[model samples]
Target chain A: MTGAALRLDDVACVRGGRMLFRGVSLSLTSGGGAMLTGANGAGKSSLLRLCAGLLPAFSGSVVRSGGVALCDEKLALDNEAPLHRALSFWAAIDRADAAQVDAAMDAMALTPLAEVPVRMLSTGQRKRAMLARIIASGAAIWLLDEPGNGLDTVSLDLLGQAVGRHLSAGGIVVAASHQPLPIVAPVTIHLPDHQADAA
Target chain B: MRLLWLLIRRDLRLAWASGGMWLPVAFLLLVASLFPFAVGPDAALLARTGGGMLWIAALLASLLPVDRLVAPDVQAGVLDQLAARGIGEEWIVLARLLAHWIGFGPPLMLATVPAATLLKLDAAAMARLELGLLIGTPALAALGLLVATLTAGLRSSGALAGLLALPLAVPLLIFGAGTMSDGSGAAFKFLAAASLLLVAITPFAGGAALRAGRD
Candidate 1:
């Protein structure tokens, strides 16, 4: 994943007939991380989606040089499958071998819940599962939207450690969070309150 | 192609495990049995009208599983996850179309064996019914997928899917039932044409709908 990068040039986002933000630009190279900060409804999630090409940019362009993984509010796993199988489905799609899945589960401390169905897992556990999915994907760029929402202090520390390891290993991370996380991201993008300005 | 196969396998497993695989077949069989009670057992009348009635039954039965076809996955963000992995929406819909047909189409044809006996259909009529279903069920599955994609995000989408699909399925019904009475093979050709057209456009239409819905 060396030389992996994500760049957004003069980006603009509009949702539901209103402009959420415009003229935002960023450039991140390998082993770098950026934190996105704003109050509620500030389009932080939407920006991450734009970077993933899930949402069309209302203006400008986004370019990336590697496979991307997004860990958002949706778990995107089958509720009926055991946690390991659910994670393995993505692991297979990502072409990540069994060792990667095992390593991801260990990283998230989810080995004990491997046999549990996804629906039975608590919120924090499900969040960890989503993170584990990103880890196992082996993608170079990670777009994490509100990744720490339901995590307790210990889980939060684990999240930070996992992200730190990813950065040290030459992966790129762009995360949106309201609460401060322990990871060191030199760049921060604080979305302006366009809604208030419009009013 | 491996990606498409993985999707089809996952969808088939989901459809089968969720018990949706049997709904349309059971509905078709139930309709076949109920027809005799409703129409009275005039063997001649049953033989004359049974094939068309079965066509109607198959068409209606195709609608039974529409609600689950695309909505659950869209809501679960499964489709988005696939898209993020660089899988095309057309490929996703195509895989789903194949899985949907496998889930309902053949089972419905097999169930038609018992249904044919219940309807007192003679051998000729039975063969015609089976052939029509073989050509027509693919179109029904495609239409269902198209409608499912179109209505996936709507409130009470099942009813809307029914409304949208029934109109599009009229050509299939007309030509499929026509085969039983039209001694000529013309009706079968027309049915095949309609089926191909639906099958050809389904992936594109369903794909565009999914992309638009994300907006």
Candidate 2:
């Protein structure tokens, strides 16, 4: 965390003849924080995808350093794997010793379903498993899409703290959230819909 | 390498524990069983078509659940996490396809024996047929995974999966079953070539899949 910077300059994207975002530019250095807010189908997720490098910007340039953990809309988990194995997805992610996995399960309230296959788990638990991965990733940039979805207040608070810790450590956090998060450090990039007529 | 291995291991573990592995195998067997019941349990007809029947059933069974493969991940916001991992979408796709094959292939092969017995395949024929299965089923799995990826998001993916995948897999099934009946070595060679081609192309296909799944 906190050792890198991300600079996006005049990033414009067009998809299916629709302008996703135009002249979008921003910069975040170590210990920086930002969030994106927009109406339904306003391309918040699209912007996040661009930042994650999953989608190439149609025009303009974006640069970033170090590993970035983007909580994408689709999970990479296969239908076959169990919960623990799915959690250990990145072989490089430092997992708790056996005790730690158990402790994480307790902390996340994931203990009862530790043996359950991920495909069988509910959406909420699945998100928790994914959060566990984010913790293990130790990445400096957290590019999240709806990180608060499927989470109760307790889990949401935990996510906020985890994200707060990342920011405190000089990491950068960028999220496209539906509801305002409970973190004080988050800054909002309010994209105005110029396309809208006076209605 | 670590990321790839963890992905493979996780997928395998899920397959083992969730019984997700068994559904296709059971479906394959069920399809095989349908042959005898429909065809009046004649041993020769049953034995003669066992290889072909098994191959098609395996292919169809392999395709059944794929309609769901990328849908949930897309809905649940896990795919974005995958992209952020910064592993190439290509490798992630490859790792996932490999896991899909492991879960869908062996069980389909194992079901062949039961299929063979149920379909009244003779002793010698069943033994020879298993060899073709062992070699050929992987070809089915590889191609099937690619198809599954291609149609992972379609409105009628259940139907589209076969519509797209069957053409590519037909040759494999043709030669695979042909060899069982005719003892032609060329069929084995063809299957091996297809398997190798699938292995080679899966990474790129997976990359394409990742891009497509993002939508």
Candidate 3:
């Protein structure tokens, strides 16, 4: 995770022929965290996506100095495979060894459900599985969109601890959530109204 | 190289788990099984036209898996995750192309044995048909992938994929069917050329399509 960084320079996003946000900028280095807060449809998720380079910024630039792992609304795991095997698919793709997958599952307390199919997991369990995937990815920068949406209080604590550990290990985290999370982030970007005119 | 192999392996596993591999073969078999009944049991007529019929069946069979090729992964964020791993879109498309070919091409060729028997084809024509499929199916796989990437996000993408691919696949069909009748090796040469061109362009074209449609 050396030299890990996620930087955005005056980023703007336009989706479906409408501008969602503009003039947003943030720079995160190793051991740094940022929380994106905004009302629904205020481009919080879009900003996270921009940082991950999954969506192109309408203007400005996003640059990353390390591998990025994004955990959004989609579980993105194979539905038919067992939970451990589904996570292993991404683990293999990320070039992370099998032990990493096991460790990630352990972090999220998902070891018991290892043999369950992903589709059968409860909503909260599925969210944990998604986080496990990010952990196993071994990526330096994590982009989490609404990671707390379906999580319980205990799971929320797990998520916060995971983020804390990742930052302490020289990784960067950029998360967007409407609800308050337990993780402490030094920087917070609260997106303004979409219709507000800001050049 | 490991990345490519892993991607191919994952694609093959997913295709198998989803039952996508047998669909085209089943469709090919179904078409072949029904062909004799439609035209009546005239062996000479069956032999002469069956080769061409097999060509048509293969072409249509190729379209069966097109909807699943790029769309599911895109929806699942598989491609984006791969992209974030510094895996280029071209490499993803290339791996998918190879996996798709393996899923359909060889099995379809094998299925053609029973299919050819059902169609009343003689030995020589069966050999020509098999050879033609070997060369032409790669192009079909390429075309399906190309169209799948192009139509991934659109509504009714399955129908749109078929519409987009059928036109582009006409050349492979021509060259493939041509091999059945011509005694000379010219049709095989042309078929090989068409396959090479499609296989070569698929990675670039399909990769661009995926990138452009990422939003």
Candidate 4:
């Protein structure tokens, strides 16, 4: 976790022949966090994907050191499995032990719901489950897209504490959300400022 | 290697949970049972044509589970999560191919026994049919999976998958059915070669398709 870093240099993104954003650049070392603030279709999600190496930048480059974990809108857990088991699958894939899965569930206050099927969870619980997956991943870089969408007050607090602990451990976090998040992202990139002109 | 096994186990569990593992076997049996009704109870004719009919049934049975193979995982974000974990798309597709073959191939072979009995096939013909299926079903599974990956995100992908897979499967069908009558070992070799080719290329082709489908 010590050497974690994420850097994007003057990146431009085009989708379906339309430029979404351009001239975007940001760099974060270990213990650093960046908040991407933009409206819908502004490419906040695309930018996060670009940073994760899941999407290519239309121009420029994204460079990262250390592993990455992304928590997006879609819950990747198996719907039929119990919450803990669903999370454990990913933990195993991430090569983390059962202890981390248990710890992540506890961190999100999801211990009580561990035995419940994933599909049975409400929206807020599902959101927390996604967070627990990120926590259990133990990746040095966390890319969270709208991590607070359906969370209530207590759950949101749990998210804040998780981000705090991750940053304190010298991990990098890049969260994209239109709504205000509880963590302190010292570098804020309001994407509209980088929007490309329409031809 | 452990990760590959883990993925195959997960896919098998999902296939079992969704009842997809049984669809191909059931379809095979249903087609076998229906053939006699369509052709009447002419025992000689049944024995002569049963092997070919069963081959056709197996080919169509392979298609039944194609719709459930790749699309659900892609929509559920499973592929993206695995990709983010540094697992290659080819590994994922290879694991899925193995799971798919396990889910349908052996069961379909077993189901062929009862299906053959229903079709009034003799012992010798039944042996050939089973051998043909054992060698050919992996190719069928691979074909289905490859087509599933290609058509995963398209609207009405199930119908599109059939149209895409059936034509490519012509060689397997020909060689598989050919084995039943060609007393020589030539047909068996052809069937094995075709199966090997499909099984070998499915991982790379399906992996590329999955990666390309990602946005």
All models, RMSD in angstroms = 1.4, 4.1, 1.4, 1.1
* C-alpha positional error of residue A141 in candidate 2 after TM-score superposition, expressed in Å: 0.7
Model 4 TM-score, 2 decimals: 0.99
DockQ computed for model 1 against the true two-chain complex using alpha carbons: 0.80
List model 3 lDDT by residue over A1-199, tens digit each. Answer: 9799888898889999988888888999999999889889888878887888778888999999998999988888888889999999899888899999999999999999999998899999999999999999999999999999889999999999999999999999999999999978999998874334753
Q: Could you list the iRMS of every candidate?
A: 0.9, 3.4, 1.3, 0.7
Name the weakest run of 10 consecutive residues (lDDT summed) in model 2 chain A.
A190-199
Tens digit per residue, CA lDDT, model 2, A1-199: 5467888898877667787667778899898888888786777888887887877888889898977876755555555666766565542444335554554455566778767877797888778776666555667777877888898898888888777767887888888877887665446776554222311
* Candidate 1 lDDT score relative to the true structure: 0.92
Per-residue lDDT of model 4, residues A61-111, tens digit only: 999999999998889999999999999999989999999999999999999
DockQ of each: 0.80, 0.50, 0.74, 0.81
lDDT of 1 by residue, A1-199 (tens): 8899999998989899888988788999999999999998899999998999899999899999999999989899999989999999898889999999999999999999999999999999999999999999999999999999899999889999999999999999999998898879999998883343543
**Candidate 4 positional error at A40, Å:** 1.1
| Per-residue lDDT over B47-93 for candidate 3, one digit per residue giving the tens place of the 0 to 100 score | 98999999999999998888889998888878878876778899999
Instruction: Decide which is better by lDDT, 3 or 4.
Output: 4
Ranking by lDDT: 4, 1, 3, 2
Say which candidate scores most in TM-score: 4
User: Which candidate tops lDDT?
Assistant: 4
Backbone Cα, N, C clashes tallied per candidate: 0, 16, 0, 0
